[model samples]
Target: MEKEHLIDKYVQGTISEDERLVLEKLKLEDPDIQKEIDLLSDLKIVTELEDKTDLKNLLKETEAKLKQGETKVIPLFKKAKFWIAAASIVIVVAIGITSLLNPFSPSLDELYAENFEPYKNVVNPSVRSDEDIDAEKQAFITYENGNYSEALTQFKALYEGTSKSYFLLYQANCFMALSNTKQAIPLLEKHSTEDTPLAIRSKWYLSLAYLKEGNKEKARELLTEVISEGGFKTTAATRLLQKLD
Candidate 1:
């Protein structure tokens, strides 16, 4: 504010040292003010470097050009309604965009931003639907409130939507939570090292699900493959082998 005041004072030829200090502070703090100050400083330097006689000649030439220019004045009646219509359209658009941006007012972005942390583990990453987004929100809501069954239902719906490996793997995790090993097998089997990140993950989870189901032979086979495949999923395979032995 003081920076703006200083600009006014400077423009009106009434600036003082104290006001100049305020302008400097404003220039340092606000990007827009800083740019204006840089431009003003450049003008001051150029004005000091140039000869007064040359500047006066340039001003006279500019004034002569201005005098030679056509002097047509636009009548306000010709475009009065056009301006009124344009202003009305601008006002309507501003209100509409503002409403869209603040549908929940200062909370939607902050709330979603808080919830949308990519670092957080997604229980059903494969689900990609508006309904699924809402269902998962409710599932997470229930999970937070310790309602495991409701969370599981929403999570199951998510698995159904995207037979994507992550969804399948998440479904297996949910099944393990519900203590239903029977449901985990097919889900895990669907994701067996087909080059997708989920393929690697599916292999790891499938081995664990097999072991959890007491089929040590199948678990051993998958665990061995994961270790031999030698890539991003190998560490998980190695860890599982260590635990089984």
Candidate 2:
């Protein structure tokens, strides 16, 4: 493929399977192109939050600038040929192109610094027969191990019955771990009402699931429920609740 057509097709997303394979290979080989993809991927994650009106406005403003000819295209960070460098200065550019093709692919959120870290010294001490506690525990272990399907199977086993709210909550967590927020929402909604130990926790998870599903009002309602509960507040949950305001 010619250089000009390759770049044009890649941007247009009209690249065929073969061209996409070629594009991926070229992105991995090229440092500069990789950075733009990484930034787009990172931005994509933050876009999931539903109540992000300020962000929406900002993007609209950026687009408006483009309409007004105020937008500047800074390829290679400069129009000057002499300023070109051989290596990418951004660490994300070097390490991120591989993550962009299926940017929504699920993984444990280790990048967030607070996601999925233990809230407290969580010790599962359930003495119930109905709830398959081992299965739930192993599900998270499998989640941490990156086997989403196996973990989901283990979680579904825990999903039956309502004896253990912890199992119920973590079952919902497994859906989240797999990035199946659509499946997660109803499970979390079932636990979102008061009377169970996990009610507040359910609202927290439900808000995020709503956000992931692009339902801001529902997310806001759930977040409000969490704040109003005045219980089950963890640092990560609290941060999310704060953002709703």
Candidate 3:
């Protein structure tokens, strides 16, 4: 089946179970298809809402004309239209109230700031003793104290010394804190598909890195993937995608 045919069936709510599954999979893999579906849905809602408003206005006009005896007989078509319009008024009013109550106004940067917080030092002890520790330990202290430049330097040293993936995640976050998303992107991208604890988190942060870099398209792509994969980040990713849309 063609995309157009599938989409038509989707809109009509007549798609087979297998076709629905296939369309949903396509939607996940293709952002353009998802966007088209969203647009179609929105258009249908607005058209229905507008039709309701128009019907109400038309009924008022018709009633006024009838009272004034403007015309002798109401045409069969007018009577049918009037009854149809009256039947839907309740439904329309309910929909109108719901739509007015929940409006969508998404701010991408605000959402990012609200959602992005540096991961706590769970890999290390939350509280440090008086021991003179190594560079990695010192780096955590700098990071906790909000000295990102020093933290980045220390984290780089830790990576050079050990080549650990955790260090890369930490260093990438430091760059992000400094608003250096360009530098953070590659590091996060490296771990996004890995099986490490930070893998899913890396995908989330990578999307944010793209967002901060003004790459909305790439950000949306990653966020969509995060939503599809389904995890702790799904809700946040879905919210971010709404704003991006």
Candidate 4:
């Protein structure tokens, strides 16, 4: 079977027993292939830290709006029913305007910016080491520092040597950070169905990548899949899908 097809079947848990045997044989003979499998399985621990700081700011803004509205008092001569109706209209209008002006709904770019944080580095030493290191280590250091160009170059070179899924995933993320969604898309899709650690999350990121590429149909399709799969990011996928609608 073709490598891509085999990978998808295996990841989706639909590979036949014979196909599983074939994949197992190939995995045994090729170190790089086995490394790819292992890395994908390992990357499953990835977690996103919500940016609550922004949420806090939003709450503060809402409070300020409410406080400002409270300052207005109707004169005793005003009709009570008219004042009540006017107050209700003002509240409804304020809410509608707030929703319309929400920074979160502005564009896919803003949504991507809100959600596409780099997966924290799990491969390299947390601190600089004293010993001589390989290209992967150097690549991660540059990546951790947000140097996408250098990190991409290094990751590309490392993948040529290791052919690991982690390298491919990180390389794709580098392309994403550099606004090269075309370059990132195929790489992320390659292992999008694999049962590896990053598999489900890869679909989520791939959906974002589709959004970045302005393919809302593709984005919605993948987001739906992510939501149906229902694991680490179903809530996030739901939120994104709602925005797309």
Candidate 5:
């Protein structure tokens, strides 16, 4: 039999003595074999524990019966001690299942944390010297130094004074860095619609903003556009889309 078949049989607790000895020898030869066996064993436990719908339905029925004024003679299953034990088991099983599921299938917040990064200041590289430190230069400086709140103020002022659309992009980036997606999304949306070089880049940031806001549908939509546009963030967008799916 194949090595994989032997491992599967071992995990299912159905391996013959000879097959078990073979797997034990394989584990002695390779540490990764033992790790794989452990992972599959854990997954099997989680899969088996996932089927608690019957227990949950029974609890609900007991609750409904109690609510309907059945105070005469409760059955054994409806006893207070039995209800407490069953409810405790359900809670423990649910928590275990959630913990196991998270690694294989990350939550939206985890995915966003893994993927969302503030777009860098490629459009306006900050000058190293302080000789000609104008408002725009100072804004980029604050942004590059990770002072997002101050940078947000500076970028807003620059945008209002000069009516420059690129400043909007920087403002959105600052909001994103500050974990303020609600403020960032509209600015990114406006910049993304413009016919400018930075517009394509804005879509990528907008997708991340949607992700931070827990709007997966909108994030997926924007990421799809980023991929179809075939520019700066295409590869990253494709990977993020796969994770979302």
Candidate 6:
């Protein structure tokens, strides 16, 4: 196959494995082939972006105007100049959009950091009396004090002993605070399925857990649910969804 055709197929992501091997070999042999591939990849992005912007319509209008005077003799050189100028404009627009999309966009980790706070100790209000601080109160105190490891141990024991569903949520929050989304997600998922008052809040934290784990699709799914449920993190979920988009 011609190198040009291979490069085009590569940028379109329609190249077969054999063709990919050929292109890889060509890239190694001639660095200019890789540059051409990069340029074409950028053009493909620009083409898609044009659909969302007015650029596609502008180009079509220009073409229509150029084709209108079919009876009049138009110079080929003039048409070439017009197309060259249009191509330059398209390239410039592509670069601008790429820059805006790439550099300024917050990463998933950043979004997670910005959006996630361990669901506050609403389940267990802190007791100032210090006299009647039981295991449950102690667990919440540890969590509120940011001692996640001890809180996790306490919450796990409470959940195992009483099977109170809120303890599960607190345990998940502890895991999240410790940066252990792997452990947090399953607990949050299980808690979110219950009919308790904290179920919706569990979904919110689950979304954040997924976000922390770099699972945007699951995070988006939970965020959408939080928004549609119409309370408890709806506004925050909406804001997070906008950032993800």
What lDDT is reached at residue 164 by model 2?
A: 57
Q: Where does model 6 exceed 4 Å of error? A: 1-100
Best by lDDT: 6
In candidate 2, which residue ranges exceed 4 Å CA deviation?
1-146, 161-163, 234-245
- TM-score of model 4 vs. true structure: 0.56
Query: What are the TM-scores, per candidate, against the unseen true structure?
Result: 0.39, 0.42, 0.57, 0.56, 0.58, 0.62
Q: Clashes in model 4: which pairs?
A: 40-196, 40-197, 44-197
lDDT of each: 0.54, 0.56, 0.71, 0.71, 0.76, 0.78
Residue-level lDDT tens digits of model 2 in 1-245: 64334444554456688877876777788755554443333334333434445445545655576587643343543323212221222333333333333456443232222333322214343343645646555556666666767756765666564355555566677677667778877777776654766577777777777777767678677667776767665555666644444
What are the per-model C-alpha RMSD values against the true structure? 23.6, 17.1, 15.6, 27.5, 13.9, 15.0
Tens digit of per-residue lDDT, candidate 4, span 23-128? 9888787545554443322222111213334434544554564476532232323455434534554565455545646766559888888888776687776465
Number of backbone clashes in candidate 3:
0
Candidate 5: tens digits of C-alpha lDDT, residues 174-239? 888888889999999999988899998889989988887889999999999989989787998998
lDDT of 1 by residue, 1-245 (tens): 43444554564457888788878777677656644443333333333433434444544543464476522222224355434533453464445445445456534223222222111245433334546456656655555454556666766777678544455555555665565656867877875635465576666666666766677788779889878878845775665554444
The full ranking of all candidates by lDDT, starting with the best, is 6, 5, 3, 4, 2, 1
lDDT of 6 by residue, 171-210 (tens): 8988888889899989998999998989999999999989
lDDT: worst 10-residue window of model 3: 70-79
Q: Which stretches of candidate 3 lie above 4 Å from their native place?
A: 1-107, 130-132
- Displacement of the residue 104 alpha carbon in candidate 4, Å: 9.6
Worst 10 residues of 4 by lDDT: 40-49
Model 4 segments more than 4 A misplaced = 1-104
Over 4 Å off in model 5, which ranges?
Answer: 1-103
In terms of lDDT, which candidate is stronger, 1 or 2?
2
Pairwise TM-score winner, candidates 1 and 6 = 6
Judging by lDDT, tell me the better candidate of 2 and 6. Answer: 6
Clashes of 4: 3
- Scored by lDDT, model 1 comes in at 0.54
